[model samples]
Target: MSETETCDLFVIGGGINGAGIARDAAGRGLKVVLCEKGDLAEGTSSRSGKLVHGGLRYLEYYEFRLVREALIEREVLLKSAPHIIWPMRFVLPHSPSDRPAWLVRLGLFLYDHLGGRRKLPGTRTLNLLRDPEGTPILDQYTRGFEYSDCWVDDARLVALNAVGAAEKGATVLTRSPAVSARRENGLWTITTRNSITGETRSFRAKCIANCAGPWVSDIINRVAGSNSSRNVRLVKGSHIIVPKFWAGSNAYLVQNTDKRVIFINPYEGDKALIGTTDIPWEGRAEDVAAEEKEIDYLLAAVNRYFKEKLRRSDVITSFSGVRPLFDDGKGNPSAVTRDYVFDLDETGGAPLLNVFGGKITTFRELAERGMQRLAHVFPNMGGNWTEHATLPGGEIPNADYESFANTLRDAYPWASRKLVHHYGRLYGARTKDVIGAAKSLADLGRHFGGNLYEAEVRYLVAREWALEANDILYRRTKHYLHLTDAEREAFADWFAGERLAA
Candidate 1:
């Protein structure tokens, strides 16, 4: 709280990697400061495919190490954040032209045995012609495989890590950007400017971490005035949201003729989330969106398999994100490795850790190993402990979400079943904090269509660093998917007026 403050670690970028490192470092008894350019997870973190999965297709590229590490992380992350993450079965309808049945079985076998899987169910053969999951599919696809993967509330996962870091004594600053940093006299002098107030602040950090995702290289060259031999490939991926068509809880995985796979997963209770095309992108990461051609391609892929034909009009909303993949010199964008690399510059006595490429599943191990790279500097820092820790609101008995849901119903018996579900799934053990002492529908305040209530919005603003209306409607919660356009406009107007009066 001065012109210049000093800390053990200073982290730039408030995405999952940055927040995760901050939490891990702080919990290890190290002083930490984390700053973000925008709201937490406002970047690619919130706009991801939202699956905590091991890249099943990576087997073709011989990335067994990455797949194994990711597979192991699935159960660890699920236990750590049970409320926001849970297992979902994916039904991959077999396509003979794309891959042989024996090859598929071999991949599935490796997926089952390669990792330390304890909780998630293994892959099973499905009869597409006889099973209800296949009722919507064409008769040609008679045999399929159903496998397990975890779904995550990607945006909330970032927020929870930030909150956990703050609780562990880290200075968490939202709407703050690290404009510049320089190493001098074995310390980093970093300047951060608050975007909201236009106020500049400076700090002295023992070490600095660059987790800027798509902006990783810019941070190295422009902010730190340093260079890394490693580079990040900005491949863009896009997803679209449509009304839920099928009856089961299982998600569908379709193999396109292009040999790329697309996921159609259940989203926000009543909708289906479909996605993803890997196209080489030259545009700015922030400007990426679902192009018209990508949308048609996705629709066509789904239309080829399911009885429920989707049109362009059926797509309610779509988003895109640029993956900061480490350049492996592969010609194909999809063939690029999802593995991560770290560069430590300790030449000036002050260390600068540059995180190159990483996925959500591997962030924990990445942080642990990253800290190990700097062990020579801080010999007294604690050992790795995040493998057994619970994230905020993830303290359920044995990470049992269903048992916890039942308990939530017992506690909030007066609340509607749907309302209880919204709170339970989002807040978990912390549901009481959102519900407070409300005992009836009147205490929930105004209803803004669907389950978007004034109480939940207020909770997010007061506790979760929610500033803009879109922060509450889109990122922190998926209320936009269920609300009409008129309702969303009204909510935005109301939010604007409230902020002005404040």
Candidate 2:
């Protein structure tokens, strides 16, 4: 028999929403327990296009409210996690065959003004023939519009939120699935099973928040034995990674023949991230992967605008994720509203808050508003604070990452430029904790290919709930992309043996 722990909130799922809510709730003086069936952000969160934007395309659907809220959140998120989120300019080549020039200008105008737009710049017209951003663009694309949005390391964002929650006294359980939850004696009883340890734990919670992304419906019906009037519409979006072909730091947004848009963003240092197609998905979310048709479609879209042609062989890797959109009866998956909807079921004196349809940009706001909905249940919990609070590793003074990086370089002059960048970009203020008392490269411990050292691995295991190599390789860092296949296998073997010995 396992011991039962009591908490004020039991949050299911470890994606951005759940982690954000747990962080927000714990900071508000509420006891929080967050459980994930797999590693944090293993689902939709990690597989996103990885942008903290205002959903500029949503303007076409007249989703002004959602876009405005997300737009405002862009700056807030950038301030909170400056280490992981930074400003990026997007270049939209004018396609006379698609949207009219006047409509594009009008949309860009609303996008510029709808949000507060403080740190980021406004939209500017571009001469594709003259501007450097247009060098890779086809000659036919003579005119373009450049606008601002922030890029994010989506998995790290989720991990940092979980770390923030734990720091605020929240319990985070990864690889632990909520097997069953029920309302008993005016409180919800939830049980979780650890997939690795085969240990079971019970928790009595006053409220349950289902932020299960694609599994929201499953948690409501199968796990909690409850139902919601709202249903999640699963839409598949896929992205491809290839060698960076375009010059400059700006991203490209091109229109497809089908009236949809595709983003070609600069990724990692020398790679480009291109995506995504909106297709109604019927298969299980876990089984989602990029198909050949989607790949060809994305290639076609990019080839249509750029002078440099990309073939299937150019793609290094591809990934697909399901969007748990709130069904609005829209026939086209592209037209489905990106807005979120919440369903609160308060029967039998216990409440189950099911979250449906939310984007990464609006996650913090979603968590804050979700807490507001439970204000009556937790009358004494503190008011909203995440809006102004800094996330883990975002403690750079005044949110200036460049200045902090320079200071870090001066402090660790012994470290190479690449090594310093790896630590500064990922750990920020916590870089010292990772480096510890190490004075030299040898002091950092065994080298595991690239800039990944034993020091960083030890730090992640101790603080960030990193239990496996993939957690560090794919999610915590993009070391896998840099390391050779043989090196990755060797590192995985070493990690497994170390964990076993422990």
Candidate 3:
């Protein structure tokens, strides 16, 4: 490589934490460079529970600090990206066989008041037989409690952070992996190879941040050749998507006999997203997939409370992510801490910060604190500004999405309700840019299937760094759920042809 380019900071892993850190650091006027082995959020960040929630169950683990910080972040993230993150109410039906009702109530009480509760409503007891929110539950359950959290577009959250970082003058290299790094003469020299173009590049950075999520240690040991006492426990989490079974928009949190809670949330307007089983994983992080037993476990948990029984055949799609948890010597995989830990190795004058264990709910705070760890290196960098700033296209007035959706309807009454909703919910204030001069649906060009319009695909490709068909189908949008196999094949073929032509 011809003399490595120098930067103030170099970040590995383009997941949420890395992206958030890059955005914050770049906005401080620092020369930043961020690289990811795969696409942005191609790791555990995109394959999450998709909730900006303060892991309610973490209360059992006595993670008061983590829960409180995440709770406070709920509203902050909502304000920052209202189009992608919104409030969600979870109905926890009381099961006498599990924890006592008072215990559940106490947990909810602490959860409601533990953080600065604003915008979202407090928890409320519900009569399962009478309350509309409890209609989906079986008659055996007589009481319930509804508490608030926020839902997030996990993939988009990472993308927005990267976009914000890029706009703030950060060099973000997707599909590029940090091959190696070494500290020399008070600066860290890092080499990266583009996975697509096979181009090798090097940079000299004053500081290095490893936010590789599941690959934190891989980056630390294999790439940076550094050591840290802090270790990561890889706990595999899996989720399954199925057709909507419940009547209301509210989500259900049914406790299993084993004390694990399963979330059945409304997803993509018509479908339902159910997930997450925690099991210790030993396989490669890239090869982790939802096993048959996991799918069964999820179905059994949901079947215990819901009136409608879900079976193996009900599963439409499934995904799995390995949580790079900070190993606190906890025996149970679920008992491990979801909170992040930073290891700053300033052994050779140049500093290396390695992060392990973090959730989507606490990414911003993690980034802020990560920066504070390196404050001595960049003493003159700008002050913290992310907490009060809106993400790209999230400049919706007062962060009110409903009002903006209404405005979109008035402007494009000719557009179908679903199409209007798709744009408003995804783009927010930037929906106009996606819809450009054309007033009618015809101007959107070809329609592949569902809401997969040609204009949106082009925009994702040219602007959002969408390279492959799955990037658009599954991550950028959940059009895979609506499109038939033939339709998907056609879209993929068209996308490949367009790329080849370009």
Which prediction has the highest TM-score against the true structure? 2
Candidate 1 residue lDDT tens string, 80-181: 999999999999999888888999999988998888788989999999999988998989999999999999999999999988888899998889889999
lDDT of 3: 0.91
| TM-score of predicted structure 3 | 0.98
lDDT of 2: 0.95
Candidate with more favorable, higher TM-score: 1 or 2: 2
Tell how far residue 234 is off in model 1, in angstroms: 0.2
lDDT (Cα, tens digit) per residue for candidate 2, span 198-290: 999999999999999999999999999998889999999999999999778889898999999999999988899999989999999999999
Error of 1 at 16 (Å): 1.0
TM of each candidate vs. truth: 0.98, 0.99, 0.98
Give the Cα lDDT of each candidate. Answer: 0.90, 0.95, 0.91
Report the C-alpha lDDT of model 3 over 1-502, residue by residue, as the tens digit.
6566989999998999999999999999999999998898888988999999988999998999999999999889999999998999899999999999999999999999988888999999999999898787899999999999989999988988998999999999988899999888988989999887799998999999989988888888888888888888999999999999988778988899888888999999888999889999888999999999999999999999988899999999999999889999999887888988899999879899999888999999999999999999999999999999999879999999989889989999988999999988888888888888877779999999898899999888877788889988888777888999999999999999999898
Pairs in clash, predicted candidate 1 = none
Q: By descending TM-score, how would the candidates be arranged?
A: 2, 3, 1
Local lDDT at 123 for model 3: 95
After superposition, candidate 1 runs with Cα above 4 Å error: none
